[model samples]
Target: MLTRLLACTIAFAAPLAALAQTPPQVSPAVEASAPLEARIGELAQILAGKGDYDAYFAPAFRSQIPKEKFAQINAQIAATAGPMIRIESITPRTPWVADVTIGFRDAIGTVRISVAATEPHQVDGLLFSGLTPRVADMGSVRAAIAALPGRTGFALARLADGAPQMLLADHGDTPLAIGSAFKLVILAELVRAVNAGERRWGDMVTLDGGPLPGGQYMNVPAGTKVTLRELAQKMISISDNSATDILLKHLGRDRVEAMLAVVGIADPKGMTPFPGTLEIFKLKGVPGLADRYLALDPAGRRQFLDGEVARTPIAAISPTLFRDGKPVRIEQLEWFATPTDLIRVMDWLRRNSAAGPGAEVRAILGLNPGIPQPAAAKWKWAGYKGGSEPGVMHMTLLLEGKDGSWYALSSSWNNPAAPVEDVRFAGLVGRAAELAAPQP
Candidate 1:
């Protein structure tokens, strides 16, 4: 066993002696001072001395990035990581090399990165062996949008592209009353009736009374015969409540309610064509009213007045004394609705592709364009309806940004106890609408 071990050792010694006999030459000064170029030399060694270059370079990409992404980053680093990069740090104090660091900007954003690499001898520079860029964040844009007061209440949803979009919301899924905005529904029903051979677009309807005060119904003269199409246009574009009521009567409240129900709206107040109980009160001869208020049942009437229906309360005194000698008062009725309901009605119009400009709610709201364009440039469509009774002043609007994004806005002022100018509330509505409108 000893003889065998000796023979094996002698064989190893022979190979060692041959290698020593032809020792390679190296500069003494280069060997002595190479530590100064530590960071640069380490990188040079990696590029030139490593047998498996990938094995040495692979760790630089120790990230969850996809292979393609890694390759892209690698290419970008190779092209931009010049001597501006330097050895930022290193673990064990390497005798011959410093650490590596890099800084660069690309299509994405700027990046300042550090890694342990060797120092460059050619130009007193550091060679980067590892490189990476900083990731960009979009939180600022989201914060800016959220911070905007007018934007705070909007509910966000993702678009097809995974981009955030918004919708005006009021808690649950209640249908908006839209006041005369409901005229679009009337218009839609009229068109449907015409299409179904039930009526003609040019069919004439006679008005038995003059327009109500502050109502669009006054636009046409009493006893004047007008085509259905004419009434619809006036009712919708001008938000004529009288025209709306008249049209609603013609279309039948039941039909409208049924249509709304089909669209997933559960609010009976919103789905109802008119407050049936409230309509019944007007029929009871209380004064300051019309026959339209008689459409509701007692329970429905009570339900309508519940706090959930509207933020504003019914007026103590009625706005009018009679509707064609039919007595009525707002206080006698129990139903209430808010401007938010009005906007929801507009949404329904758009979703159902009902009548209005382009038969879509977006076209009616005129907000999709963010700014009011010229009539020739799409008219900045908008859905607007205003309501007033004694101290009650209310308006609801749905505006669309130029990109078809929408905003629902409602404003109401109930100061029956202290009486405010109706015009003031109207001005507020306009202002809120303007504020809610999207801008480029």
Candidate 2:
């Protein structure tokens, strides 16, 4: 079931938004033609139904995504979000592309369709993003955020020229525990280094660290050689702890810190030596470690970490050891970021990051496309990265609309007394996405 969900979510390959120097503009007559509308309707019906939809697809698209693959995707969607109920709306963006809103029994979603504008219109590209219909209402978003079980922070911004317009915010400037979402900082730093010619993505690095039990590649031998690009993919895609630590070690703490400083992160001290999953687990596992670590100042904590690293091995600790401990000092040990600060980071990445590294980042983030992204059709491209531990949950998204505008949405939920309810938090974030959707 989980495998099918992942397959359905990550099935779509993002289309190149621009291929030619200037795309031919759609004329008003062509835009208003009944035939084009009928074609879109027919395609949507075929896609929403269970039977083979190959007749509607272009030869190239058919070859790329075969009949069996389409069936699997359909089945996965049904199993995960239920069958499609209706087609709410279809808006043509270009002669070749249209934004579609699809309703499922469980939720509403958007599908972006691009077709070859030839004799027989055929699908050239297809992408799905889950979205809620309430996204356009700021009051709805505010109500959702207010109803969350624990302390919550969120920021939604429209990425237009100059400054971002904040649509909704609740404690947006306050730093909170952001779990593995901090990986974005590492990714940004790596991209910066790559852009500056300090490192190549293909550079092979040996994975020499002790095995961390929390994520993928744990069973692989320590000395296995892999490209920096592969490590970055695993780190962001699966939240692979070993991959993160390896990349961090290769990039060095100083470089990441410098990157943070340049980005003007709010809580620089909280991230100086970002803790690997294993290190965090070890700290949680060792009795009395949390209290002692929290009692110290930043410098003292750094000294404590050095001692702990020297004294302990990851294999000796278990991730579940501190599960029973309530109100742990997660804020002090784990990564922290405010929604505003995170939005700034996303803005920088969207505007300044090079094309190659930016594409890679988006691909990695698009791997786990589970979050509800209400009004998904308005977005031309969407990528997401989220993180969670016992008491911390965080989500961040970078999105581009069909109109050539960009946006960023970030939110965090934290509760020291108990684990934050995952469903509730995700639902709220989804509502927030609805509010951040592009205005018609």
Candidate 3:
């Protein structure tokens, strides 16, 4: 499952979402002469690390995503999703746009691609979301996640009149570290503020400070004007830390903390003194700061983040803190939430995103439906948010089942002693999500 280049498909104008988003699955169906269908073979070669980049893509596609960057995205997919095996299906939306199901050694995946109508028929764009493991039902998915090392949790719930009817769960009440997934709270706060008339989606704010890694906003000049909608859109769609921190600051840190209870965090005190993105880097960068901060009660940590940690120079925060590609105080330093807690959070967003500037909330979440085709087709409407760190992995979704009922799936995996494999975790989560049955 590949997720970074999704926004690049068609006319890639917006900042892309996360780099590791994966989508859904389905049966085999091949069209012999659908125009764009012929290009699928070339895509297979490219994804398998053997295709010709210059010949398979148009200037427009090549210009936005350099050959090297394109290759890297494919390498990342192979690293996680395993090597490509074959094509399962190609369902064309148009001669230009189509959803193609692909088989990988570890999982089955669906990808969206757009091709040029003229000439050699080069690729215009492509979006890779996620992968679903070859499984018979949710039971197998739950078992696999349970067998994983360290802390792991999964929940399948049906939303009935604003409440969760637990359909299946494993460690559903245990809170685990959720990396960028914390942006959901920030989004909920933004919606609440807009609904209260405190701010408008059109409100523009000068981007504060420097951009951090893992985001396009990292390269954007500080102080560049950006709108609430743009920031929020980038935040969830790509889990942009820079956008998240700016929105967190603009909304007021304390207000966001207060929103925990409003959004059903279970234990609001667990996340009190919520730290912004920069604050997190500083906490990890400073020698022994994480252990000290973790040792303190929520109130004390808040004070440190507001005072000593707040004043820490940006230069002191080294990107090297995470360079080793290993967990760095994840348990003591990341956003905490349980499986059921996430269900409530998604429910809040689902019920409230129907009107006003808040109306755009749904679109933002669905900008990249972390799951693709056959599995994706299970829901009439779908939205996803996930987070990852060295030892922490999370995939959470808000889905409207085909019966017009709503459902939420929250899955998490954390290893305190080592790193968790991305592709394996994605396959497990994707299966449970695909098996979502609302009425039961």
Question: All candidates' lDDT scores?
Answer: 0.37, 0.65, 0.75
TM-score rank, highest first?
Answer: 3, 2, 1
How many pairs of residues collide in each model? 52, 6, 12
Better by lDDT, candidate 3 or 1? 3
Q: What is the RMSD of candidate 3?
A: 5.7
Q: What is the lDDT of residue 36 in candidate 2?
A: 52
Summarize candidate 3's per-residue lDDT along 299-322 as a digit string, tens digits.
888888888887777666554664
Q: Summarize candidate 2's per-residue lDDT along 238-342 as a digit string, tens digits.
A: 666667777877897678777786665866876765665556666765676767877878677767776865477654544445434254566666788888878
Order of the predicted models by lDDT, top scorer first: 3, 2, 1
The TM-score obtained by model 1 is 0.42
* Residue ranges of candidate 3 with Cα displaced over 4 Å: 1-39, 43-83, 92-98, 113-127, 208-216, 219-223, 438-440
Score residue 87 of candidate 2 by CA lDDT: 85
* Between candidates 2 and 3, the TM-score winner: 3
